[model samples]
Target: MTDPGRPFPRHLRQALRTIAARVYLAVCAALLVWALVVTTTDSSDDSMAGVIPLLATAPVSLVLLVLPDHAAALVVAVVLGALVNAAVIGWCARALRR
Candidate 1:
């Protein structure tokens, strides 16, 4: 039986699925870029580990500019990215739930 209480329409559901997939792909791509950067750079010490977080933040910052003025974009990006990552983690956890 269909759940009448469900709020999303078919198209909206599809769109969310697409967004989630894209976010997953983007995260994977970002990780790959980070790995490449680390590999190419001199591994003198643990200092190179810091670059991964910076690279991850850059794309999120760019995405934030789409919503508001440039000055507020950094704050918006950080908040939005945190929320998105949290959602992704929750989704994964639910999928793994027994």
Candidate 2:
């Protein structure tokens, strides 16, 4: 028989999962913001081309993690950012291909 005063086992598991998800999302947001700031502020000739996708994807991934309820917005952002990045890369590749 279950104890009258004790909570169900699944409740604790669910709560832990929620907390973990929030923490992961917050970390992703912080990383995205940091990378964005760095990329914008620094103007070295060394190509930062690689970091752009990381900047774009981090926020979207955070949204997916923390706000599963808002999956549409998150997914749209991811797709649009990816397409933009791809287009830019394709342009560069074509230019180099010539």
Candidate 3:
């Protein structure tokens, strides 16, 4: 039988999970912004280093890892991630055609 005084582990686990989810969300947001910057910058420069794809996919991926049951978060992240990736690719392609 679980002891009445043994709530610490459960509380600790939840706290850790919440912190992880927040961190993942923050990172994803940053990556999305970085992808936009990469797209706008000069194509001749190597600042992006071909990481746009990874940035595009990181939102949903990291959110899922942090909050598996958060379907809403997953959907939002996926949609946003897709849009970010699309924007980056579109800009890059346009830069190339110039």
lDDT of 3 by residue, 8-86 (tens): 5653344334433445446656765665566567576556522543444665445544545543544455546654444
lDDT of each: 0.50, 0.47, 0.50
Candidate achieving higher TM-score, 1 or 2: 1
Ranking by lDDT: 1, 3, 2
Provide the lowest-lDDT 10-residue window in model 2: 11-20
Highest TM-score scorer: 1
Listed in order, each prediction's TM-score against the native is 0.37, 0.35, 0.35
Q: Check candidate 3 and list the clashing pairs.
A: none
Roughly what TM-score does model 3 have, to 2 decimal places? Answer: 0.35
**Tens digits of per-residue lDDT for model 2 on 1-98?**
43577666643333334433345445445654565566567788564533443455554434444445442544445444443444444445444556
> Candidates 1 and 3: which is better by TM-score?
1
The residue-level lDDT of candidate 3 at 90 comes to 45
